[model samples]
Target: MIISCYNEEHTILQVIDEVSAVLPQAHIAVFDNNSTDSSKSLVLGRIQMLANSANIDGGGGTYQSFIESSAPESKNKVPKTQDFAAKINVESKRAESKRLDSASLDSPANDTTLFNATSITPTSINPASIIPTSINSVSTIMPNGGRLSLFSTTTQGKGAVIADAFALLDADIYVMIDGDTQYDTAFLPQALAHFCQNQLDMLNIARATINDSVHRKGHSFGNKLLSTAAAIFFGKNFGDMLSGYRIFSRAFVKSFPAQSKGFEIETELSVFALQQNLRVDEIEAPYKSRPEGSFSKLHTFRDGFRILFMIFQLLFTERPLLVFGFLSVLSFAVSLIIGVDIFMEFLETSRVARFPTLFVCVGLGVIGVVLGVAGMLAHLVVKGSKEARRMAYLNHKKIL
Candidate 1:
């Protein structure tokens, strides 16, 4: 289980506890992006309490080092520049060899190191022992002998955190949920069961709010509009294109090229699945309002435009033929409309008039032809890219 957290101090612990109770067999890793509140300390304290209860050697040392680590230095650090094209080429090379290492991809090479312990003993810790208590009294357990790892990086945004976690944690079945206790964890088991039973590559938990007050009106409207746009552009009706809670098979997680740096990540995820024609499904889950102190990180206007732009970007990249073809048709239509009157006049008079308009019409015609040819060529390239991505996805064994 991978939880992406920021300053979710009021509800992060509760989310951890709820996940622990539901998916005890799953190893929970919380990727904190330099939270300013007590979120980091709270997670570290929980780790320490679990370490003590499990009696795992070196666990205490790991916990202490985590506390003393320089996570503070990362609090104000700017996110690294993401050269997506270069990264995609590198990933393609790695994928060709079918040996993509998540740990090495987009790692905080120069940033301050946070908690990096990966090999802690898996011990059963009681969930009830660590509920809303002081750090010393917290006694959370790692269920089903699964270890709990906390990773802190300077990279900002939920998308960056998730990208880091996907690369850092190795799991057969990965579950990603927000730290903001808005989505009910009770739906986890059902979602997991469906994902595994159907052997899906990705399963999205579409938000079904209990009431209209659960989410902001603007957010709700934006989600619908974005989802509708994605459905039309991608030809997939993903009920909630911006849903944060999702499940992924190893293949999907390892093969995904996470490029979004903010709330647009969800949009990227949905489009990727659609472009690849991966086995995916969605189930409606109850969505609740955030805790009083916990706030939403999403900016309605800013992120909405970002996501909308991402959709068009993906369309141009993944379905270049469709985008260019539409433009080509528009170009041809305009050229014919303008040239029709000019051609009729020339034929009737047997003389050239409005040469500039005729030139414009001819130029548009040529551009239309060029765009059409370009679309076809780009379509071929996109097909090849899709095949390569599919091969990379197939290299990983499915959970079933």
Candidate 2:
């Protein structure tokens, strides 16, 4: 199981504990983006607590070594528990001061932070470079003999962190859930059961809120609009396309080309599954409001527009004929509307009165024809690309 976290301090620990309860035997990896809150300290504390328990149960390793094993490349060892606690206290005070100072600045009503794709370069680190060389290695072992790894991505967006995790983690079945603790972890076993039983490539956990107020009006409307748009474009209805919780088979994960750098990654995921005609399923899961201190990072309008743009992009790339053909028809219709009267006048009078209008109409006609031909040719190229990707998807062994 993989959890993507930012500044979710209020509920991160609870989320971790819930996941641990649900999947005690499974390795739980938490990938953290640079969080200003005490979230990192809280996670580190949990790791220490777990490390202590492991030592008591005859699992041989210290908390310090476990931290080092998670990131073998780092030169500095984490400070011991007491020193770490002191550092966290000092840092928290400084963060509070900074927050107060910035509170006076005008900010968007609901947006915590606007995602800037170009700000952070995509991560280049390979999975092999970070994962423990051997699962059985003493330094890497966790409580109950399952690995609990904590990693921080230098890249900023949720999509970037997830992309990095997809590259770094190797698992037969991958479970992705947000760190906000809004979705119930109770449905995990059932979701996993359904995924494996049907041998699905992707199983989306669609959000079904218990309370209407829990679902923001703007976000709810945006999700419905985007979901409908995706269904129309891709010919598949996954119900809730923006839901953060999902399960994936190794075949799907390994084959997915994750290119989106923001919230629109969900759109890309759905489009990929549709384009490949992969076996997919969806199960309704209870969604709730965030804890009081925790805020949402999603900007309804900004992210909604981004997701909409990504859908059109996928449509153009995957179904060039549909897009270009529609434009071709539209162009021809306009040209005929403008030139009809002029053509009739020329026919009756046997003379040209509006040569410029005629030329403009002719230019539009030519453009229409060119677009029609381009669509046909581009459709062929897209078809070949799809075939190549399908071959790559087939190369991976399917989950039994």
Best by lDDT: 1
- The weakest ten consecutive residues by lDDT in model 2 span 98-107
lDDT of 2 by residue, 39-118 (tens): 87787777666656544534222212243333333222232434211011112222222110000111122212211000
Q: Write the per-residue lDDT of candidate 1 for residues 1-400, one digit (tens) a residue.
A: 7788899899989998898777654567778888999998888777766654444333222121122232333432321212000000112221232211112112232334332222221222222121110111111224233445567767788889888777765556778899998988999989988988999989999999998888899998999999999998888898888999999888998889888888899999988998898899999999998878778888999989988998989989999999999999999999999999998998899887899998999999999999999999999999998888899898985556
Q: Tell how far residue 143 is off in model 2, in angstroms.
A: 2.1
Alpha-carbon lDDT of model 2: 0.70
Candidate 2 runs further than 4 Å off: 52-65, 69-140
Candidate 1: residue pairs that collide: 102-167, 125-141
Cα lDDT, model 2, residue 279:
91
Q: lDDT for every model?
A: 0.71, 0.70
lDDT for model 1, on a 0 to 1 scale? 0.71
Clashes of each: 2, 0
Give the least accurate 10-residue stretch of model 1, judged by summed lDDT: 81-90
